[model samples]
Structure formats: C-alpha cells, structure tokens
Target: MVHTKLKYTPYFSISSFTFIMIRLMLLVCVLVSFAAAIPWLSPAYWLSPRAWPCPEDAAIAPCTCYADDDLNLFMDCQNLDSFQQLVDIFQVDFPFKKFGRLQISNSDLRDTLTAAVFPDGFMFREVIMFSNNFLDVDPDTFLPSKTELTFMEFSDPTPNFPLPAELTQLPELREAVLSVNCSEIPAWASDSLVTLTIRCLQDTEFPSPLNLSHLSALHLHHTNLLGVPVNSFVGSPGLQTLSLNNDQLASFDDGALSFTALHQLDISSNALTTMPQLTCGCEIQWLLGEDDATMPLIGIQNVTLVCDDGSGKFDDIRNVLDQLC
Candidate 1:
C-alpha cells in the first residue's frame, strides 16, 4: 500500500487566517464610521448627555426622550390655542401605578379636554386646577371609569357655575374646594361629598336638604350666608367639625347644634349676640365661639371665645364640665 504524504504548509494556513481577520476588522470600522455620520443610527450616540439641546444653567437635566409615565404628574398648557396640542399631550396612556398627583392649574384650557382626552383607567388621587374655566365642558367630560381621586380644588372665574354630576361617580372622593363667582351653592352635588369648602357664596340660601350623613368637616368661611336654617344639619350623623367663621351669620337656629357626633365647632368672628344650645351632649371637645353672651359655656374644654370685652374670663366653662363628667 503506497500512502501519499500530505503537504503540511503552516505558513500558508496562518497567512490565510490573518487575511480573514484583517478584512473583518476593516468591515467593522467602516460600519462604525457610517453610523457615526447619521444622527439616528446609533442609540449610544443619540443618548449622549452632551448632545442634548438644553441651557447650561438649567436646573433640570436635558432630556429629549421620556418614559410613558413621566408626563402624567404635571401638565401645564397655559394659553395653548391649538386643540391638537391638548389632545396629543393628554392622549398618552399614563401608567397609573407611577403617578399619584396631577396639577393643571392656571391653564387656559379650551374645549380640548373632553372625555376622550384622558384614558379610561386613569387613577389620579389628587387634582388641583386653580382659575381654570371648565364650566363650558360637558357634564360628562371627566367621566372616568375608575379614579383614585381623594381631592379636587377648582376655582372658577365665571358666575354661572356648572357642577357636573359625573363627580359622584368617583367613589373615593374626600375633599372638594370650589372658589367660584356664584353667590350660591351649586345645586348639582352628590351625597358622596364629605368635605366641602366654598369661599364665594354670596346672597345664596343654604341649599335645603343637604345630605350630610357621612360628612365630617364643612368649611363655609368668607361666604356671605344670611342665615342657615335650623334643619340644615339635621341628618348629618357623622359630622365632627363645622367652620362658619367670617360670614354674615346674624344667628344660628337651634337646629345648628343638633349634630350628635360633632366634636369641634367654630362659630367665631360673626355677628352673633347669643350662643346656640348645642345638644351634642359632652362629646364636644373644642368650642371656639364669640363671647357676646352674659353667661359663658357651662361645660366645654379647650374653649377659645373671641369677645369684644377683651376679658378672656370664660375659662371656668371647662371646670364646670369636668365636674359633671
């Protein structure tokens, strides 16, 4: 058997391998150079912090790209004339798990904030809009399916205020502060409202049949109220705090003190000459009243009376109540 001797050329094999490696290196360099010339070709080059178009002394870092959830916390479209801008900004589906508070205050929002502006599952817990005229919005403009909203503060500039009935759909609402130009309470309120603070109720009657069974705090400060009827708070079983200070209340009917669960009551700095016999039975802890009567409160602690006589001598009201308790 004649076996042929195989030619072993190590130099030739090494030369071929080196040539292939050199060609691969040259190809990689050309690709990289081409990517560097284009603005949107390389992600690393696009994301470089030095390439951002922001001012040198800016407090925030320059950002050309944003996550889907970053824009939900704050949206200020003050005097934005185009409706498309409003729709584009609010149309993004913001992740609810990341956002907790949203503020759209002092914005000249036009008719672009309809119900379709926000996603259906938006869950904002707090929303504040001071001096935004949303009265022209449809009643169902903010009809969200599920909202974790706890508070809403809206200050309107127009006198003919229109409260939407869709507010009652929010099951978790706790506080609503409305500073409107109207002189009376909006008739379109729901029973789910617990804390209401109205600052501009002038020449308006305390709307009769106010459902306050679940209300805990009520503030009517600086609202021109002539007189609250006796039966205004008749059904508020869970009322704890009542503030009617700095109003034109000449007198309170006996029904004002009918809340059994009341704990703190403030009726100071009003035009009152006599105190209403609050029938809350010893549950009241703080009674801030005006000292215009001859006899002080017989039983109450932490009493602060604002009197014209300047004597602060009604300190003995708590001592009398302590003996009875």
Candidate 2:
C-alpha cells in the first residue's frame, strides 16, 4: 500500500464549479447572438425594415404609427440595383400584419413571385409593385385572400406576367397597371376593373373584342396595335379615356370605339395616313392625334392634331386639317 509517486486530480467546491459553468454558457450565448446578426447568415432578419441596420448617428429615435404619410409602409428598394441584392434584403416567408397601403418600388426584385414572400393573409387596400427592369411574375402575385384589394399595380416595363384573371374576383378592385404582351385581353377584367394600363412588350396587336362595360380609362401604350379594330372598344359604355398612344397603329376602323363613350382620346405618335371617323359621344378634353392633320371626331374641346414632322404652330384643329389637305 505504499505509493512510490502520487498524482493528484484538482477538484473545486460546488459554488466555484457552478460559477465556471455559468461563464462558459454566457460565452456561448454571446457567440450565437453575433452569428445571428450577420445578414447573410440570418437573411430573414435583415430583410425586415424593423431589423435593418441604421446609422450610428440615428440617436435611436423610436416611434411609428403610419409607415409614411398616408402609406402604411413604403419599401423603396430601387436603390438595391441588382436582383441578388433584392433577394438579400427581402427574405421569403417573412410574417407581416395587414397594411393600408404598401408601395414597393424595387428595381431589382424581378423574381417570379410564385410563393409567398410576405405574409399575404394580411388584407391590404393597395399594393404597388413598380419600375422593375424585368420580372416574370407568376399567376399568384398575391395570396387568394389578399385578392380582395382595391388597387394593384405592376408597372414593370418588361414584365412577362399575364394579368391574373383571378383579380376579377376582387369585389373592390378598381385599377391595375401591367406590362405584358397579352395575346388576348384578360377575360375577367370586365368584372371590377375601372382603369387598366398595359404596355405591351411584344410586337403584337391589341387584343380584340374587349367588353369592359364599366371601364372608364383604357391605356394601351407602346404596342403593335395596327389600328383601332372594329368592336375593339365594344360594350364599354362608361369608357371615358382611350389611350392608344405611341404604337404601330396604321389605320383606324370606322367601327372602332363606336359603341363606347370616350371623352379623351390619345392616338399620339402612330403611323396613320387616314383618320377614320368616330361616333363616341362627349366633348373630348384631350384629343391627342399626333402626326395627323385631319381631326375627325364626334366632339373635341381641346385637340392637338399636329405632325411629328417638326411643324406645330396652328392653335386650331381646323387650320391644322386645312394644312394637311
């Protein structure tokens, strides 16, 4: 039982050991918190405006009711400048509450929104997605329950998303702006839309046989509409403004827009050698028929019947028509 050499193991009291364990745990917690603050590591948190970084000089003022003025939230990501940056800033599946108006002007968020990025269950009054360079938007732009919106706008210049006809189910929907080369006018658009602005991206003619009986404004800009076709503005009794400006309209049909009631017609900057007569009742305030002299119409209060050939001095439509003749 005699030991030649004895090595002793260090031991601590209960309180001392507990203190050491607590310090180790605190160190792990600090590391975890630092890791979560990394934007790339925690994409969902940084994408949120609530968790976004602010300047050190911000002084940490905190108070908010409205997002900005009448708008509940305004996400101005246009400065992001790239698709990847937009994705880094806005993570998918971020939960959110209902907002009055949410205006997202992103130049880089051109991704096809097939899945829910933001919590779409929050019913919104208006949602504006605009100015993206190119976006191939999917059919379910917003959630089904969110479809009961008042106004929805997708004003990307080269958007390939077809107008989701499901928007017609929105009982309160009024206006929509889209940029897509549609082969045919969205069928259900006649249900609740009062104003529509479509900038066709392809070299195609405007879809025919439109029946927007309640539409007040129809803007078909920058397309290959080879003239206002017969029955094109049919059944739109309340149609007030018809804008087919800056397009490939070669000629207007005599039966074009005969059934509708137009108050302001804009056929500016088109290739037109002839101006077909119209029967739309009401004195149009702005009859903008560029590159043409013969102003043929039912009634026009203020008309700009001038040529794009750098000669516009006549203040009267009659004088301009006389010069062309």
Candidate 3:
C-alpha cells in the first residue's frame, strides 16, 4: 500500500559531494605542509637543490637551515651578530621541528643560550660557537633550562678564551671543545664530561688531575703550558689517551705523568727539553719509532716515550726501557 506514492531520495547531492571533496583536500594539504616543515620528510625534499640537502623554513631571519641526506638539520646563524637577533628570528619564524645542530659564529659577547631567548625549548644534539669576537654569557644562562645538549665546541677570535663567569653544571653535556684563558680548570666545568679538550693560554698545569678522573680522553691544545706540573696526571687513572699538543711546554715535571693504565700519549709540537718519568704499570703507545730522532721519541713494545736529548739519545731511552721494562 505504501508503494502507491514511493519516491527515491537523491543518495548524494552536488553540494554535499563538493563539500566532502574540499574537506579531504584540506586534510591532505595539512599533512603535506606538516611533512614539509620537518625538512627531509617533505615530498619536495628531492626537488630543492642545496648542499647535501635543504631544510625547513630556510627563509627564517638571520639564519640559514640545511638538511643532510641523513635527515639531520643544521641551523647556521653565523650572520647574526647577537643572541638578541636570534631571539628576534624565533619570535617570528620558528621552525616546527627542533634542529639537530646549531652553529653561531661572529656573534656578540652578550649572547647566551637559555629559555628566555628560545622559549619554545632549544633542543640540539650539537652546537658550535666559532670565530666569535666574545662569548659573554651570564651565570647559569648559558644553556637551555629544559633540554639536554650533548656536544658543544667553541673558537674564540679574541685573545682570551672567553670562559663563562659562572659555568653552572650542564648535566647532559658529554663532550666539549672550549677555548679559554684559564690557568686552571674551572670549578664549574662538569665532572660528568667524557671528552675534555681545553684550548687555553695558561702556562700552569691543568686545574687538577684529581678533578678530572672521569675523563677518558684529555687533550690540551694551545694551552701555553710551560710544563705539566709534578703529578699532574696522577689521579687520571681512567684516562685512556692524553694529548698535550700545540703548546709552549718546555718540559714535563719529573714524575709529572703517572697514569695507571694509559693507552696513548701525544706530546707533539711542544718545546719539551726532556720526557717525564712513566710510573710502573703504565701502558705506552709509541707514535714515533726509536730511530725517528727528529721527533725525539722511542718506539717501545707497548709504550710510547718522548725522550729527546736532541743528541740522538733516543736509542739510550729505548735501551733503558728494553733493559728495565
């Protein structure tokens, strides 16, 4: 009986169909833009031409971003003269994703890395502050408050090393290459650090070997060391490799270096008149052979020693080791 006036409703209307299509296109566009903001994941990644690759928001102010084939993003702000300039960039065109590395050079002395500037939370795996005129960071405002950075390097153009006044402990920092004018290791330097490379202008010995027992590799470059003090390396039993290179060191104190189990020692390019005594049980790795008198070292079986009488006495040092050791 109801079929007498049965009429079929239009299953789909033109307006409704158009609306659904528009919504789907909008969703696709959102996804595409989101991927594009992540640099390497973007569909246009291969289309853009750059060294290694390109990065998200390359147009951001006072900085240039680059992406590698490994999907690592590097932010270069060498052109920016101050931290305030960087802050001004993020205040306007911040990236959607955190950067993998940040490089800032030729910047001002007042530039500091902290939450007040990068309020969105500065997350970086590596950082480089190179060729800077000065690095005048305030106490405790040098690093991000929330994020944990791993590696940091610096190159100061100024005469001083530009060491921070109050170097608050950075817990997540593992490796650091700092250029400072410190006569001794700073108290604020993190003890949890693994690799410590200090480029200083001091002729005195490093702060204290006891303070850096946790270090595995210790490199002191351009430190202007007159000599490593006696027992300077007494407490660094954990140090596997020690390098005192590119300095003004005239000599290492007698018994100045006594590592429990050192694997390698590099005392190259220094003005050393004699070699320090190696304690018993200390391992050695000879970088130069005994006959290589030009370098003033002996190529021992397991250890490396630098005994330059400058009179072809390298053989004498080797003979001594061969007899006693």
Q: Which one is best on lDDT?
A: 3
Model 1 lDDT vs. the true structure?
0.56
Question: TM-score rank, highest first?
Answer: 3, 1, 2
Model 1 C-alpha lDDT per residue in residues 156-245, reported as the tens digit of each score: 655543246545676677788877666766543455678878878456567654665578888887877777876676556677778777
The C-alpha lDDT values of all candidates are 0.56, 0.56, 0.60
Over 187-212, each residue of candidate 2 has an lDDT whose tens digit, in order, gives 45456779987776666655566666
Query: What's the lDDT for residue 113 in model 3?
Result: 47
Instruction: Give candidate 1's error at residue 69 in angstroms.
Output: 12
Error of 1 at 293 (Å): 15
Worst ten in a row by lDDT for model 1: 56-65
> Highest TM-score: which candidate?
3
List the candidate 2 regions with Cα displacement exceeding 4 Å.
Answer: 1-76, 81-96, 145-147, 157-159, 181-188, 277-325
lDDT of 3 by residue, 1-325 (tens): 5558778899876788899999999998988888866665675665666433433455555578777777777778866666567777666544434667878787663644444665655567777877656544433443553155677787663333333434334666677798754566553344566787887655545554445546788887677766666666655567777777778877666567666556567777876665655443313323323455533234322233345454644566655655655
Per-prediction TM-score, please? 0.59, 0.58, 0.63
